[model samples]
Target: MDAVVIGAGPNGLVAANALADAGWDVLVLEAQDTIGGAVRSAEVIAPGYVTDLFSAFYPLAAASPVIRDLHLEEHGLVWRHAPSVVGHAFPDGRAAVLHRTVEDTAAGLDADHPGDGDAWVELHRQWTAVRGPLLDALFTPFPPVRAMLSVLRTQRAAGLLDLTRLGLTPVRRLGSENFGGDGGPALLAGNAMHSDLPPDGAGSGFFGWLLCMLGQDVGFPVPEGGAGVLADSLRRRAEARGAQFRTSSPVTSVTVRGGRAVGVEIAGGGSVRARRAVVADVVAPALYGDLLPRDSLPAGLLRDLDRFEWDGGTIKVNWALDAPVPWRAPGLAGAGTVHLGVDNDGLLEAAKDIALGRVPEHPFLLFGQMTTADPSRSPAGTESAWAYTHVPSGLEWQPDALARHVDRMRTSVEEVAPGFADHLVGEHVQSPALLEEWDANLVGGAINGGTSGLHQQLVLRPTPGLGRPETPIEGLFLASASAHPGGGVHGACGWNAARAALATQRTGRRLRRALVGTAWERVLRDPRSPR
Candidate 1:
């Protein structure tokens, strides 16, 4: 094979497809019996109710430039949207709904609070102006020259400064600074909380704004049949381009004859040699800690791995509901994704409790009404609903403790939806342990690869000086969610890695030297970065 990809997740498959398109012989090795790491769907609870066992909604997937270029729709992946993208339910009688269009979303807010509509529109307009360039910068490999030029071309000093501030400020502060009412802020906070990030966490504002705006621009869409259909589409595209897939073949280690990665040694005394490159789409720890030979890693790299931070653990509860959740606010029923907030202070408190290693008394919940987006998810009028909440990653997880957290989550939901508990015909609970058991990449249930916080992002991602995939080993590259532009079903990570590998094919040692120099300047030069 010209190249071997370990793990058949979205990023892995994407890289494989791209490599095949570039005329390379690509082979994808998946650990599970099936493909689709987090993108798989199954009838976990009931026969008729199809549940996305892991990742359900994909606003990022729609916005990805690579995915758009691949044209998955032509490959049988049909994206279904909800009438409204997001609904933030509060203790008040009403809820804040973010509809498909900014005007409609703002109008949904305008009816309850005067001028809040205008506030929402103005922010969205600002988002609209830089959105194209910002998304380009976000999705592309860093030192994103084209994306930065796009940003510079679109805006002058003030708007660029605003983008800077948005990147720097916390979600709570950004909301407070912009809106007078809780609706807009709650929406931002809820979206930001989609990761394990606290409402006040740095870089959270970007997540909130990006998701909320993207939801308005491209509704929080799901595949018509199932999320697995998405994986199938990517697979079909890759296979059509001549990519081979090897299922249930786990890579035990990267075979290193010299300093360069020659190929991968599979579990059960087997091996697949990559004639060109080895692209790993697993987590950083699995790539560095378990797969690669320890002697192959630098002492400094080992130390950095030791201090590597992971995102908080998550608890998801999937329900086979008798009918759509009858939200007290009524408006929430139409939204595919609903967030149960405790207002600004309440949200902060929930984050605080998780940070403090205590199960929250009032957990902030992210709800998904699958049938709203795709009716085929369940029988006739019934719904397949799921909600997820986070906990401190270090918290010792046990069955009894998991049960208590589940109760807390249920209570949080019941408080807003009134008789929400009554709608549950069957239930499926996945704790952090169970999530990891399903897919090793889900490490400690840190869904977004790792923390979505700024410290672990950009040039500092995965590890300082190693963000763009090319490792010290000549033919080795890291393309996992742990890489730059961490997690989500977006294929940026693997694409970046594959592109880097392709660069090596073009420039060989010269490109490696250039990449090393680039990494030194971008990473090692930082005074705050530990050597």
Candidate 2:
């Protein structure tokens, strides 16, 4: 193969498609029987009820230029926006809804806390000024030096200073500084919880701003059929461009020669050569430990891998409900997604507990009513709801323990949304271990690959080096969510990796040939013996 992509996850598929589009003969290898990894839709509970295996909502899908330019809708993919972007409910029966329209959302905020309407409007206005440049900096290949320069040039001196300050502050501090009301802080904290980070963590403010602004700019929407349909469409487009997919082929190793990746060794002793490049969409730790030979990796890289912290694990529960969740607050019944807890303080407490390796008594639960978002997800008059909560990583995943936790989550939701547990017709719970088994990228149910903390984001992602998707080894790249731009179904990581690979291929092909003899001699004469 001209370019071989290991793991047919969304990022892998996107990378393969990009390579194929650039006229490379691409091959995608997947360990599972199905092609899509986390982006899968199946009738897990009932015959007709379809549930998204992992990711359901796609706020990034609407905002991703790579996905947008692909015209996935033309390829049988449709997007359906929810009536309200999201809802955050409190224990005391108070709820706040973020609407698709900024004005409406501001009004909702004002209703909740008297003067928060103007505060929200001001926040949105500030976000609008920097949103384009910020997104461009994030989504595009890094060392985003050019994008940063452009942003600096465009914004006035004071605006630039404000942006800098916003980037540095934690979500809790940012909310406190920007808006005085409880509603503003609650909304900001809710948005920040989308990442594994706590609201008080450094740089979490950026995530809060980014997600809330995205919700306002483009409501969190799901694919018409399910999240899998989006992947299917990408597969179709890639296949049309001459990309080949091999299912159930798990890669065991990436074959190296002269310190360069030459091919991959499959689990069953089969090998496939990559004539040009090997793009791995797998998580970083897995790739280094399982796929590559230790001798091939630098000592510094291996040491850094030891320090890598996978994000907290998740316990996911999907339910086939007889009816929509009856919220104590009536307006929340129509929400597509809901964040349930007491308030911002309660949410922070939950996050703190999870970080300390204990499941919170009142876990910050994120619930999605798939049927409300897209009616096609369930049978008529029925609803499909899924809820997930972050748990400490590396915890033993026992079925009985999982069931108990599920019950606790049920009770938590019921406290906010009355009669929630009674409506469950069928339930499916996936423990962290189960999630890791399903998709290796979600190592121990760390959905975002690595923690979205300040040290692990943007340029420092996957490791501190060139953030432009290139690896130290020639013709190899990290294109997974572990790379720059982080997680979500957006193909930015893959797209950025493909573009980098193309650039490297253009320049390195000739340069590599010239240095082949010297490189081989150096490889053979190395003092380090192969284990």
Candidate 3:
């Protein structure tokens, strides 16, 4: 094979497709019997009622240049935009609905809180100025220095400084500072909760702005049929370019020779030799400790790995409903995605409870009604609803315990959308342990790979040297969510890794030659090393 990708996740597929597009033969190996790692969609509850097993909404997907450049829309990937982008349901039967148009959303805010409309408009205007260049810097593989220079040029000095402060501040602080009214801050904080990080945690403010602005620019969309359609489209595009996918084939190890990755060993003792490079879309810790030999890893890299923390796990519940959820707040009925909580304070309390290893009685839940967003997701008049809540890291994920929590989450939703529990014709609950069993990359159910905290983002992701995807082992790279521009369904990480590999193949020299030499020396000294 010209290149062997170890996982058939979106990132892995994207990486393989890039190599194939560049005229290199590519092979993808997946542990599961299917493709699309966390992007899978299935009829888990009832017939003709498809539910997204993991990611449903695709704000990032719509904005990703990788997906747009691939033109997956040509391959049956039609997107359906919701009229009401999102809704936050408060305890007093009042809901804040974010509309597709900024002016409309601002008008709605102004109704509740005077002067909030002007604040929202100003914020939107500021974000619009830098959105394009900011996204380019994030999704491109150009060195950080060069990328920063580009950002500086595109967004003037004052704009660049504002961007820096926006990226560094916590979501809670950003919300408090920008949005003077309670409704405005609550809206910002709700979007930030999509990541496992708390609103007060550093680096979360970027997500708040990104998600909110994405919602304003392009409403969160769901692929017609299900989220799987998006993945299927990518697979078709890859196959068209001579990329091959082998499902149910788990890679045991990435075989290295002479300090260079040459092949991969599958779980059943089969091996495929890579003529040029081996790209892994597995999580960082798993790739380092399980796939590669410890002696073949640099000491500093290993130390950084030890300090890396996986984000909190999640429990997902899917329901086949007989009817749409009856919302207590009439305005929330039109929303595709609804958030259930009393207020921002209530959300903070719930987040704190999850951080302390105890499930909150009223958890901060993200509820998605696929049938409302895309009518094809369910049969006529029927609804398909799904919700997920974050849990403390490494908590015991017993099935029975999870079932009780699922019931609690359902009841919590009922508080906002009355009669929600009664509409369920069928239900499926997936605990954190179940998620890990489905995809090992979701280690401990940290779906976004690792924590999205300030200390672990950008060049510091996975670890400093490994952020750009190049590893100590020549021709091996990290193309998973663990890399820079972390998480989301965007293929930036995979694209960057593929570009780097192509560059190295042309140069005939690895990027981290010194690190490779050190690892090779340690491997040679280990008497117990396998020949």
* Error at 412, model 2, angstroms: 1.1
* Over 4 Å off, model 1: 517-531
Clashing residue pair totals per candidate (backbone < 3 A) = 0, 0, 0
lDDT for each candidate structure:
0.87, 0.85, 0.84
For 70-180, candidate 1 gives per-residue lDDT tens digits of: 999999999999878999989765689998888887886777677888988988898889988888888888779999998999999998898898887899999888787
Show the colliding residue pairs in model 2.
Answer: none
| lDDT (10s digit) by residue, model 3, range 1-531 | 999998888899889889999999999999999998988899888889999998899988888888789888877889997668899988878888888899988998888888888888988987788777777777876356665666677787787788888887878898788766677777788899999878887777888888888899878999999988888988998899999999999999988888789999998889999989999998999999899987776676777789888888899899999987899888777788888854888778887887888888878889998888999999889889999988888888677788789888888888888888788899998888888888888887788889888778876787755357888778998999998878899888888889888988776674346553444444333345433
Residue 289, candidate 3: C-alpha displacement in angstroms? 0.7
Model 2 misplacement above 4 A = 510-531
User: Where is the poorest 10-residue window by lDDT in model 1?
Assistant: 522-531
On a 0 to 100 scale, what is the lDDT of residue 485 in model 3? Answer: 78
Deviation in angstroms for 224 in model 3?
0.9
Q: Which numbered prediction scores highest in lDDT against the true structure? A: 1
